[model samples]
Target: MKEIDFSKLIVTLVQPLVQEPSAITVTERDTERYREYVLDVAATDVGRVIGRQGHVASALRTVVEGARNKHINAKKIRLVINDHRH
Candidate 1:
């Protein structure tokens, strides 16, 4: 399996989330073998992206894992969705 850089992979996925009117912020915590991704998006957009019952988030996680598995040894990857609605 080819090794991948988790940090760069995260940035690539997160960059597009911020393009919409709603603000999207991503923070990453990196360790020797794992990385975590925290994604904060406007509440309105959250539904649009995450879908009903979190299917969207689950799909995204799958994609991330597939990509990561191809190259790097990742212990875990987390996606935290922050709602920005009042």
Candidate 2:
């Protein structure tokens, strides 16, 4: 298991799908049960990241979770997408 930069990974995966690349932001919050990654994108790009029927978002979460599971860590990881009108 190696140190994984989940925030950077998310940003890299999402940057191309957004119109305002500079507005993309990823933040982390730690809880007793899990670590949460909050992804904020320009309001207009939200749909792009989410994709139709939320398939893209689901896929993104899958990738992130898969990586986390590969490492031997007790804490779980969560991905949250938020839209902002920056």
Candidate 3:
């Protein structure tokens, strides 16, 4: 399998979300092998990205996991949504 850099993968995946006009910020955290992403966006855009019952978030996690599996010492990926309140 091809090698991948976790940090770079994260930045690439999250960059688009922050580009949206209603998006506030994207924060990322890496701990050991796991990575956590928090996206702050306006309420309207939140539904657009998150999808019904979180299908979009699930898909994002799936993609991240696929990338993580190609790397060493990586296991978990998480995405959290904040309604631009903080």
- By TM-score rank, best first, the candidates go 2, 1, 3
- Pick by TM-score: which candidate is best? 2
What C-alpha lDDT values do all the predictions have?
0.64, 0.88, 0.63
The per-prediction CA RMSD against the true structure, in angstroms, equals 3.9, 2.2, 4.0
lDDT of 3 by residue, 43-75 (tens): 657765676898876776678677666355354
Model 2 regions more than 4 Å off: 69-71, 84-86
Clashing pairs in 2: none
Off by over 4 Å in 3: 1-24, 31-33, 73-75, 83-86
Error of 1 at 53 (Å): 1.3
> Comparing candidate 1 with candidate 3, which one achieves the higher TM-score?
1
Between candidates 2 and 3, the one scoring higher on lDDT is 2
Q: What is the TM-score (0 to 1) of candidate 3? A: 0.59
Best-fitting candidate, measured by lDDT? Answer: 2
